[model samples]
Target: MATIKITTESVAALTKSAVPNKTTFYFDNELAGFGLYRTTTGTGTYFAEFRPVAGGSKKRLKLGRVGTLKANEAREAARRAIANAALGKDLAQNRSDERASLTVEELVSKYIEEYVAEHKKASTAGLYRMLLKKHVKPRLGSIKATSLTRVDVQRAHALMTREARVSANRAIKLLSAAYGWGSRHGHVQEGMNPASGIKLNEEEGRERFLTTAEMLAIGNAMIEAETIGLPVDAGTTKHAPKGQLVVMSPYATAAIRLLMLTGARLREILNLRWSEVDLERGVLRLPDSKTGKKTVFLPTAAVDIIKGLTKLGSYMIAGESAGTKHEKPRSDLKRPWAAICKRAGVNGVRIHDLRHTFASTGVGDQMGLPVIGTLLGHADPSTTQRYAHLADEAARRAVEAIGGKIAAAMNGGK
Candidate 1:
């Protein structure tokens, strides 16, 4: 080691020199209190070290090769390191400590790998991945988990609300779950969940159902559209829009028809295996339902629809591809249903509303509350009480029938 009267330019020249291994130079400069000397150790590589104090134990740290670390900046850094050492402090330890602090990206990765992947179902896990990828990760992945604030969560929620309220709610729910998992495992400190209180006001009350006139109009339109499409070649189109298929099984049509006619839940109709239908008995056996499995007797018209559908395929509801078992039956009701509704001029009514239509029409027809409940597969009779006007109308009809008899007897006695 040699103590050279050092300047920034002198250190730069020394760092630029070519030599057979690492080199060191002690320099004194106004900008760089300590300067380094380094040279090429092998092809294209060089190393250098610097210390501020001339006679102090060498704090030899590697500086990069000829072109990488610019001479001026390296000299300036060398000066700062020397200055720190003169004050008996280690700059390297401070860098290491800063690097060790937890970042949001690191915590999210650990939470997914350790908690979500291990415990959640494949479908549910996929949903979580989607929520995090679309909503959470972009906003907060780079933030430190321990330092996550309610404001960060609120900002994410506000952005999501512009896209969709339901989706915003789902994103918030998923984020809460992730944070809860972190808290349970001691990754996050105790506090109220930022996502906990946010609520999305969705469209509530009973779903809208199409009326009988609407159903007739829909059916006639589907027939006319098919007649119109007869001239077109099948291969001409790449893909039909949802619910727009031209040809359909009588069974599928009836299944959809019954869905509108009787207002049965889509899953109730779709999940109907051949084993569940008793054509001769006129009773459908639901092994389980949303309200728990109970036997529901089909009305004569509904039974007629079931009989027509029994001929379509092994499954009660058939898909586009015939003679193949659908991984899950009754998956989609695209094209044909859309064509039907389009012809009817009713827009934005979902297939599920067929059941709603059934309930609504029954209520309109003055069916008793208990009868409507049974027809709609409600386990609790009280659930059917919302349509109490139907029962009131039935009671009025009964009184009218008795009143006519009483009037006849009174007239006869007079």
Candidate 2:
């Protein structure tokens, strides 16, 4: 029995002792209808247990620890536990019951396991995991599901936007979906999605396209640099002879030329497989495209590039290997694209813009909107209508050609 006076000094002195195992501190007084006991069970594990002296039967009430819970703090807790015990209430059991209710972190885990994996695609599941781990979990993981507010969600979204606008919008959408899932199931109360009214800022339209002169300049630069060779890692012994080195696969040069001739999307051309192309039939079959499924008929210039690519390897575009199952058919084009643009003296012309240039050029050459739409694989006609102004300019050229034909006919009759 370790006897300690009911004073604040004695409580502090008793807790600082080097007792390795369980030790109980006993108070001298009856404590005025309150009984406080400090129980130390090994290092760092300390708790204050309280029992009533004046009221009913003995009921143990745990009040935190020794280091965290001070002598004054333990006395305050003992007083409350005495009052609650006198009223026949169990304070410790009530706290345990309250904690048994679901928290936001627990609900998020459940949502991912039950909802996200089953319904959404693999990429979507990956996105949800990233948003929750990076944005939502850190700020609101400990909050109770029923207690979350709209302001909490607003702050989370705002924090994400500080880094990136697109990421912020994606986080807001994921949060909305999670809360909606919580509401549908009984984890959260009805009509209580915190992210319900949040809206993302409008995104700016893509307006970057290269001119024919700019395209020609880029091709000329690639011809001058002639740096096409396997790039060895720095400090390695695999250095190539000076002036003999050339950038890997002139595919950007080939891809740009093909896009200008066929007006196909950059991805469609970059991801093209040898199995998908029919050089004999003069058509290229694109199995997976933005418009679902489509094919492009190659012109003489585009066909010549395809024939030239077959001499390189299995892939039509002999660029960087994407580490896919088939070594030949790659999923992406590497830095040769940027190197080509650097040589061309063109600023900010992305690979995708080559496709835009192709469309604009087709509309400039008197091609019909319907004809250009088919060539571009536009899922909706409205998508192709953005290039209608260019189509109208081409129509004027066609009208002039017809006018010249009519004049020639009249002159021949005279």
Candidate 2 residue-wise lDDT at 241: 57
What would the per-residue lDDT of candidate 1 be over residues 1-414, giving only the tens digit for each residue? 556655445555665555645544454434434444443453222223444343565555433333444556555566666567667665544533433475655665666678778875544566677777777778777777766777888887888778777767787777677666555433554333566666554744655767667878877764554455411122212355543434544555667766766667776777677888887888788887667777767778888767655344556777554456544566656655665665567888888877776776777667667778888888888887766765677678778878988998999944
lDDT of 2 at 357: 84
lDDT of 2 by residue, 208-258 (tens): 667868978966765654454422321111345544445545565577678
Give me candidate 2's TM-score against the actual structure.
0.57
Worst 10 residues of 1 by lDDT: 229-238
Q: How close to the true structure is residue 326 of candidate 1, measured as C-alpha lDDT? A: 47
Kindly report which residue pairs in candidate 2 clash with one another.
218-344, 226-246, 227-246, 227-247, 228-246, 228-247, 229-246
Cα lDDT, model 2, residue 42: 32
Supply candidate 1's per-residue lDDT for 139: 78
